[model samples]
Target: MEYVIKGYEPADALRYFEEISAIPRGSKNEQAVAQYVYDFAKDLGLEARIDTTYWNVVVKKPASPGCEDKPAVMIQGHLDMVCEKNAGTAHDFEKDPLDLYIEDGLLKARGTTLGADNGQAVAYMMALLARNDLVHPPLECVFTSMEEIGLLGALQVDTSDLHSKYMLNVDCGPEGTVFVSCAGGLLQDISKKVRWEKAGGDTVSLQVRGLLGGHSAAMIDHEMGNSIKVMGRILHGIQKQMEVHIVSLSGGSKMNAIPRESDAVITVPAGQGDKAIEIASHIAATAKAELAASDGGLYLQCEKAGATERQMSLADSRQIIEFIFLVKNGVYTMSMEMPGLVVCSSNLGVATTDDTGVQLTDFIRSSDPTIRDHLDDEIRSLAQLLDIEIAPADPMPGWKYEAESPLRQLFMKLYKEQTGKEMVAVATHGGLECGILKDKMPDLDIIAFGPTADGAHTPDESLDLASFERTWNLILATLKALAEQ
Candidate 1:
């Protein structure tokens, strides 16, 4: 395959990135990518291996020529990418590779997510392991799978074999910022059963689309429109004015993405289809006005569809709508200590309804466990009222801000010396594997940084070419400094 990215230092990083991008590596489908990494390590004559359960890969390279006595260092990243694409994209996350391209100095994938979120980390690690001239300590490049799906793979890895105390997580913000902390999060799966009845009425289909959906955790504070929530409002609004029965309602592909589109099909009393459409259009107009600042492209389209035989009982439909309204979503609270920092939030990522019932995938995050629990309690109460089952997974622990981090300080000093700007330490609301790894290796000192990227977890994802190289150079320099210490 022809590479779109060129003239980048550590050219191996971009070359390996292009090669890996050609493999299908959607979350839970990372076996092939893991094998690729293992193969690359084996070819380099490095001690590389893969596991059966989670497909986590580890490649070990001995210390640089003069740094054998220095403490070993671990650089980690996830192997999976969030598989999201535009509606018309002909890509397959399980079999087809990403179509990489270059646009206006940024690297992009046509109609699909660029996968640079974690790919950069993988490529950089590969490049470093393959480079013999670079001054560095013993290298341990750990690639875990299924990180996009609740850190499943990272949670499963056995850290007992690792010898590194200083770990660099390559999954944070752009070059200058070294991430010190991140919020903890959990997924709450809500399901409710519904009874279907024969439909004998006119059909109206409503689609809410074109919203600027993104990473639910990182972009929740942006207040972008959530399609599932939008559809819920539209459904409720139609019911307020006229009797209706829901035929189907669904949207969203990933449990961690702000759904870009939502769709609903319902049946109304014969001859009342026009009224339903009119009410829906009015509600859409109001929603558009509300979303203009963040989701300017949001629009709702309503049309008549061929009649269906079965529809959900009004009781079930009402229960689902009420549950959606009761659920707490978006940025719940901001930190008082840190200005403009979102301390707590939840996202209604996906909503789907079928003949059996409706299942809603929602996630919550908070730096404070107490606040997270409080929000969970609210959702638990809603589930109880609706007599629905809400299964909450064990929460991912938050990376707490430490008063003293030698690795962080080192990076800060090196960043200041390398560039004239002060390196800022920050926390992401998005869940990083750092928290999970810290839980396993309590004493592991961790810091995270990456190249500039935009629209992560969405199809519009792009990587900043300039920041990409700057970050690579900084990481190389940081590694050299650590070896010297």
Candidate 2:
């Protein structure tokens, strides 16, 4: 395939990014990318180790010239991307390469995610290691897997060989903004046994689509429509007027992404089909108006569906619908200290009703440990009240902000000198691997910053070329300053 990235500064970084983009590295599937990094390190005669079990790669390069006394710096990023695409885009994330294209000075993937989130970070580390002229201390390039799925690789990777007191996490957003803290998060699954019986009635398919879904933790404050909740409302409204039984229902794919589309098959009384459509249309219109500013493309439709042999019992159907409607979603609260940052939030990421039961998965996030515990309790209490079985996954620790950090202070100073503007140091609502790594390496000073990117964890994700060049320069300058210390 022909490369689409050209005429960009830091040409080596851009070229490596394109090469990384060609590999399929979705969460839990990072073998190929990890191997690629390992091979690159081996080819350069650098000491490297690859842990296939966790899909992590660690490479060490000696300090340049007189900078041997400087503390070793660890550069970290994940090897995976959240595999997301538009409704009808026929691209296989496991085998096929991403179809990358350039648009309006930004790098994007056609009808799919561009994987620039951590891919660019990998490219930066690779380019830096490949160079021989840059004056810097000993470098340890660490790449972990499954960051999008709760930072699993970071939590499990063996870092005993690493000897870095200062770490640079290149997995942040908005160029020039340094992140010192981020929310901790966990995954939860709720389910209930559902019985099905033969149905003899008209079937209708209800669908909710076109909402601008995004990263649950990062964009929950945007007030975008959640398709699962929207579908629940429409279903509840229809059930209030007529009797119906669900045949099958499914929505969303990943626990980290807000569902953009959902559909359900239901059998209603022969004469009540018209009423169901009318109710769905009314609800869609109301939702559109309410979410016009955030999700203007919101659409809901109901049409006659083919006959089905099995349908969920009315009791089970009603219970599922009520559960979805009652579940807490979106921004639960804002931080008192940070003003605009989201302090507590949850995303009803996935829902499916099948032969055995109705299953739902959610990702809950909170910067405060107390709030995180409270949210977990709230979910359990709700499940118990509804008589549903629930299972909560192990939670990752949140990175707390420290007012005094030599690394952050140095980065801020360098950023100001290079750009003539003070870099904003703020906490993020999203979960980052830095939090997990910090917990393991308590004495390490960490800072995360990256180039500007939009629509992450979604098919519309894009990276700004201009911001990429600028951020690259900043990283080089920071490394030089660190070595001088």
Candidate 3:
């Protein structure tokens, strides 16, 4: 009987992709999906290894015919998705499978992110395992957990027992390009505690929203408005004309996603309350005119709310506000070789004020390891300047491309013979398993390829129905070429 499951067809990868859509596998919570892979592999009679602590699964397929002596190849892709949603979208990623639908030739989520970033690749590998007729050398397929949160699972992988000397990672964007290298990144947290004070009169909240936020490294150059920056501009504008005491400030949802909105609560003297609104209006007008093409929907509003007149001390508030203004929050430079590619960047991802202290999170990325470290140092200097505690978390290393890779040459020849066109090979500015896997298996030849996926790490994540078939055909053709060799 032909498999008609949501995401399990041998000919169409979408079949397997549909099955992934029904599973809840957001970052750090990958137990269910990990078990699914284990069960799926066992049912197919493949040798499966499951790691309980890390929730990693690996499946091995024996070599075919005369290829038994060939070196084993590893196929790797992450199992977790970045859980992000639109404001007011009410789907829980922990329990609810992503709601997937098609519109105008693009697959999209219902006001949330479609987990296609790595899900499609996972499904594709699973489908390959179910096939009985395909011929190739021995294979090892690895599914890692919590890659979105960090390369935690990959880091925890017990590589001592692995048998692969070469790997092909399927967790990258753009089908036509073969990503041979990528950038490294680091996450930093800056925090400060300030004394609270009581206000004499009325208190209100100011909010900025509707900005087009995106992946800080990928979309930073677009010049789309930033919610945190917009809020800072308004707050500074208000401070110019009147005396306002900040009660609290909060915005952003994740340490990775660009913050699309922010809110601040402050006590506005009844005398200058009207003036505060006037200044906000002026900021909004300027933003509308400036962001008319990109952040046209940007909004700034002041609303009355019931609150204690208690607020942070004046000195504390001033220092925190100044820090936000001084911090770097966008594309730092462009690649000299790859005109449009971002060589270095950073994002002031999130910030919030609480009873103890104000916590802020920033993420930085760069293709050069030295530059990534430099950026982290710059942020640490900011914390020192403001007398705040700072923490820099794990840094993911970049994949360095090999100019003399035999596998790359093989792929290039295969594509030219199959399509009569030259293949596009380049390095990406985003993180991929290629970097970590390379670190684990230094001599392992690696290359990353996938179907056409646009607007990844966002609500518009989707796979081209037509591209899936073509890409799968290419994968199969490549396998045939390798078998002949």
- Winning candidate number (TM-score): 3
TM-score sort, best first = 3, 2, 1
Stronger candidate by lDDT (1 vs 3): 1
lDDT of candidate 1 at residue 230, scale 0 to 100: 84
CA displacement after TM-score superposition, residue 253 of candidate 3 (Å): 2.5
lDDT of 2 at 249: 78
Backbone clash count, each prediction separately: 0, 0, 4
lDDT tens digits, residue span 444-469, model 3 = 88888887878777876777766666
TM-score of each: 0.73, 0.74, 0.77
Model 2, span 164-273: residue lDDT tens: 98899999979879998898887788898988798868899989998989988778999889998898888888888888787887899988899999999898998778
Worst 10 residues of 3 by lDDT: 1-10
Off by over 4 Å in 2: 1-46, 62-70, 79-120, 126-138, 145-153, 197-212, 234-248, 264-289, 296-315, 396-400, 451-473
What are the lDDT scores of the predictions, listed in order?
Answer: 0.87, 0.87, 0.78
What is candidate 3's CA lDDT for residue 208?
87
